[model samples]
Target: MTSFEFPGQYYELMRRDFRNLAAETDFLASLLPDGGRALDLGCGTGTNLRELGARGYCGVGVDQSASFVEYARRMGGEGVEYVHERVEDFESEDRFDLVYCLFMTLNYLPRAELRRVLRKMRGLLLPGGHVVLEFGHLLNFVESYQPYTVAHHRGDGVLVTRLARQSLNPRAANWRNEETLLVREADGRVSMYDNFFDQAVLTGPEVRELLADAGLHVSAEYGGFRKEQVPPHGRGPVVIVATAEGAGAL
Candidate 1:
């Protein structure tokens, strides 16, 4: 089994995948409300920040990956700023109109750690500011057994990999999943990495309860930006839109 670590070196590669999967322009347009300031947790290579900037929002991206942070700085535009730091230890006196965690990054944290991170995000948002979380629908695992391969070419080099052996433990409530990544280079060099993730797979009702426990209100829960209800069989990812209670409401 391959050991997974925070801020992996392949983050930029993963970012490219996300940019393709997520309709960044539309997603940012839908989430940015009046657009004062925004914080992107687990910002990866800052692709989302760039998308938000294009939509006229000032964006700051935070990620644990130093390589990703540096790459983002070099690609900077539209008032985008990148910070290299872990979400748990990141400190800021400034608050944001919107705080977002996307791409199932929150699932990497343990339950206690996930709660701590949520509370930290809560503290960073202005009263009534929105927090949007996007994660894979856990129920999809029931049918997700097929292996898939993805490849990309950079200059003269090619990166090819196969992902296979998907498994999940739903009873744990943390949505633990396992898979393997096999990497091959044009130079004939090969490497393999095994990835294990513990995701908090809250059903719609469970998510509502968790948000309430965190002192936030569930403004919306969508299977996708398409705004469909979560299908019983989990056809798509889940997007959660929540708002911190205004000071008066608190």
Candidate 2:
């Protein structure tokens, strides 16, 4: 399976999407403990880390992309540290009060890799720490659909845009697929990558089992961070908040 990395343009798009930024900030704020230390896993460009730091929390971000990490470090303040490393290989001498994996970043890994990463996340949390995870709902892709396309106008000419059809390996334990497309214009050309995570459909039960195996308990699962329960055949994303079973007492 191919790994997903947001291009610089996409990262900037996320930074400008006020609605999404507000929703995410609200969700993270709700999950934070008083003056807590927070970890942003797969933190692209460190946008969330900067927000957390602005809110007076000690925030650290980790990502495999060196350019992204450098950009994040330059953009984020001193309170927010950006680390260049894969989530599975990230090690810390101290535990955090909260760990977050957002934007379906976990879906990039296969089942075993995901499990191992989750174990690492568990190990990086303090006793009362919580993990807030978000991923796309797989049920949305049960049926095939035409690709969505968009084009932008350049000063001299029009940009060309196309989205190609993609499919998930239904038989695999980690059922997921990606849609890759080309973005071409007079200035430059680039590939845009978007992945559909059907892991919720193929591994929801297994995810719960694995969390339990890791000594974590599911506190809640929402259709989105807005706090709505996921419905049967829900086409929205899934946001999960989990914690160590007895961590609340710590």
Name the top TM-score candidate.
Answer: 2
Residues 1-250, model 2: lDDT tens digits: 4343544444454345323776788788877887888999988788887877888888889887776777787775747887888877888887998999987677655556777778888888987789887765456445433345343323233232424444445566344444443545455755555533334333466667777777788988888767777877766667878898775421
Positional deviation of 1 in candidate 2, in angstroms? 4.3
Pairs clashing in candidate 2?
Answer: 138-198
lDDT of 1: 0.68
**Against the true structure, candidate 2 has what lDDT?**
0.68
What is the C-alpha lDDT profile of model 1 across 1-250, one tens digit per residue? 1124423335555556544535655754665676668999988778778877877889789887676688778778797898888777787898988898887776655556666677788888876688888775556554553444344424236463535444446566645446455655568787776666556655556556667778777777777665667666666778888887643221
What would the TM-scores of all predictions be?
0.76, 0.78
Identify the candidate with maximal lDDT. Answer: 2
C-alpha lDDT score of every prediction, in listed order: 0.68, 0.68
* Count of backbone collisions in candidate 1: 0
TM-score of 2: 0.78
Clash tally for model 2: 1
Q: Candidate 2: minimum summed lDDT over ten consecutive residues — where? A: 153-162
